[model samples]
Target chain A: DVKVTQSSRYLVKRTGEKVFLECVQDMDHENMFWYRQDPGLGLRLIYFSYDVKMKEKGDIPEGYSVSREKKERFSLILESASTNQTSMYLCASSYRREDYYGYTFGSGTRLTVV
Target chain B: AQSVTQPDIHITVSEGASLELRCNYSYGATPYLFWYVQSPGQGLQLLLKYFSGDTLVQGIKGFEAEFKRSQSSFNLRKPSVHWSDAAEYFCAVGSSASKIIFGSGTRLSIRP
Candidate 1:
């Protein structure tokens, strides 16, 4: 079965700490995305990469950055974690420009910044 | 800008009851519609999707959705819902482009 795997299921960090959330997909998909899900707000896109090393900001990319150095790996970075950044982060991948194919998502990482 | 709307924040239905979850979208041109379900602490799973051809699409787990371009809505339905079907449902819209916009989601609870 194809899968998008997230490195951590849960993480707790102190304020001002740097954080890294990693995602890896085995499907060889061309598009990778990062989204933060909050209660009542559903999921908001943080960033997405169409190709390796190419990243685009999403609806809420203010406190986040991303790295896609390899085809199968995409990493979301938090420059300085704040309490407001605490939320569930999900990573997803899909075929390029083919929204009809839908997306395969990771189990997600719940980050808590204290 | 593309957007999706799931009006109900939460819904409670009895087991073996027929179910329907509402979804609305706003997008330019033809839109690709999708329905996904997320169990507790699990990733979202694709329930169904509508791109072209038939307006009604069948999905896994006895779920179906109909695409209504005139109303800009894609509503999901099931003849009978099971206890295992209790989960959060998300409606999403996308174009031929690379991004998809998701709705706030509707949490479904099954009653005995």
Candidate 2:
């Protein structure tokens, strides 16, 4: 079975601290994405990577940055964690535009900024 | 830019009742649409997708969605609701390279 695993299922960080949430997929998909899910706002995209070392900002990328150092690994970074940053973060991966396979998501990481 | 709207924030239904979840989208041309379900503490799962073909698309977990070009809608439906079907549903419209805009989502409640 295809699997997408996040580095931490639950994480707590202090305000103004640097935080990183990691994701790795076993499907060899070319596209990976990071989204923050809130109850009313749904899932807002933070960043996405189409290739190693390349990235693009999404709708809500202002408070986040991402890294794609390897094909299977994608990371979300918060330069300075704030209380408002507490939310459920999800990672997803899929093939290039040519394929029909939909995105596969990781279990998600609930980050709490204290 | 493509976008989706799920008007209903939550829907409550009986365990054996029929169910329909509404979804609307806005796009310049013919768009690829998708429906996904997320269970408690689980990742999102694709329930169905509509690209082209018959307007009605069938999917896993006894789910079906109808595409209406005139209305720009893709509404998901089920003959009967199951307790396990209680979850959050999201509708999205896909752009090139799999870029998509998703709706806020609708949370379903199945009352036993």
Candidate 3:
């Protein structure tokens, strides 16, 4: 089975502080993604990486950035965390863009900014 | 760009009863559609996906969904509901780009 591991399951940060959420997938998937899940909003993509050192912004990438130094690892960085940024963050990986290979997501990290 | 919409925000059903969840999409051509289930505080799990071929697609946990091109609807169905099935379900549409758009999601609750 493919396992996606998240660095922290829960986190707390003060407003204006920097935050980092990490994800690692055992599978050799090429595509990696970072998303934030909010109630009544579903899952919104923040950033995605197609290969090592390649990153792209998604629907909601205003206050967020991502790093993919390695193919198996993807990290989401909140430059300046705010109360509104407190939400559940998810990481996903896929084999390709058009292929039927489904997304394997991490357990997710629930961040609370005070 | 492809987008998805799940009309039902919350649904309640009794155990052993049939279940249906509605999903709609907006796309110019046939878009790849998927259904995912998420337990509280967990990641989304793939339930099923429809890329082409047969309109009706079978999925895990005895669940299925039919793709209606005319109406642009892909509704999920199950013969019998289980208490363990109570969770948030999301419908997504994948485009040619490397991104997939997800719906607002529907919260399902099973009554014993």
Candidate 4:
């Protein structure tokens, strides 16, 4: 079955450390997104890419950046980790056509910043 | 601004009983509506979606949702809920754009 794979399921990083969370999709989807899931807040979009080397900021894009070097790979970067940044990070992918079909998500990477 | 609202933060229901989770949306036009379930420590799975045509849509695991344009609501219902159905349900709305707005989510707990 097709899937979105996140490289890490859990991670602990120190404050002020640079962190990288990787995601890869096998479905050849053109759109990829990163969202942070928090209790009582649900999931909030951080960034999304519609094509390679292209990215757009979502509702909550502060303290985050993204890279799409290849069509199948999208990476989320934390310039400097903070305690507030600790949350369940989810990666998802979908077709270029908007809302034609729902997104396929990765198992998610829960990060903790100390 | 487009947004989704799942008013109930938590719901408890006995197994083998009927279930309903409410969801409402506010958008400029007829939007794409979806219901997603996230089991403990798992990714969100699409329960069902409504784009157009029939207002009522069937989804996996015997779940269904009905779209009421006049009410701007798309509520999920199940004839009977199982123990395995305990999970967090999120309601979402999407426009013709790339992003989808998700509600805060409702956590469902099944009682014995």
Task: Give RMSD (Å) of candidate 4 vs. truth.
Answer: 0.9
Just chain B of model 1: what TM-score?
0.97
DockQ of all candidates, in order?
A: 0.72, 0.63, 0.67, 0.67
lDDT of each: 0.94, 0.91, 0.92, 0.94
lDDT tens readout by residue for model 4, B1-112: 9999999999999999999999999999889998999999989988998889999999999999999999999999999999999999999999853778999999999998
Q: Candidate 4 has which clashing residue pairs, if any?
A: none
Q: What is the interface RMSD of each candidate, in Å?
A: 1.6, 1.5, 1.7, 1.6
Model 2's chain B yields a TM-score of 0.97
Regions of model 4 farther than 4 Å from truth: none
Misplaced by over 4 Å in model 1 are: none
For candidate 4, lDDT tens digit of each residue in A2-59?
6999999999999999999999999889999999999999999999999999999998
lDDT of 2 by residue, A31-72 (tens): 999999999898888999989999999988987889999999
- Tens-digit lDDT track for model 1 on B41-63? 99899999888999999999999
Worst 10 residues of 3 chain A by lDDT: A95-104
Assess every candidate by TM-score: 0.98, 0.97, 0.98, 0.98
Write the residue-wise lDDT of candidate 1 on A35-114 in tens digits: 99999999999999999989999999998899999999999999999999999999999977654688999999999999
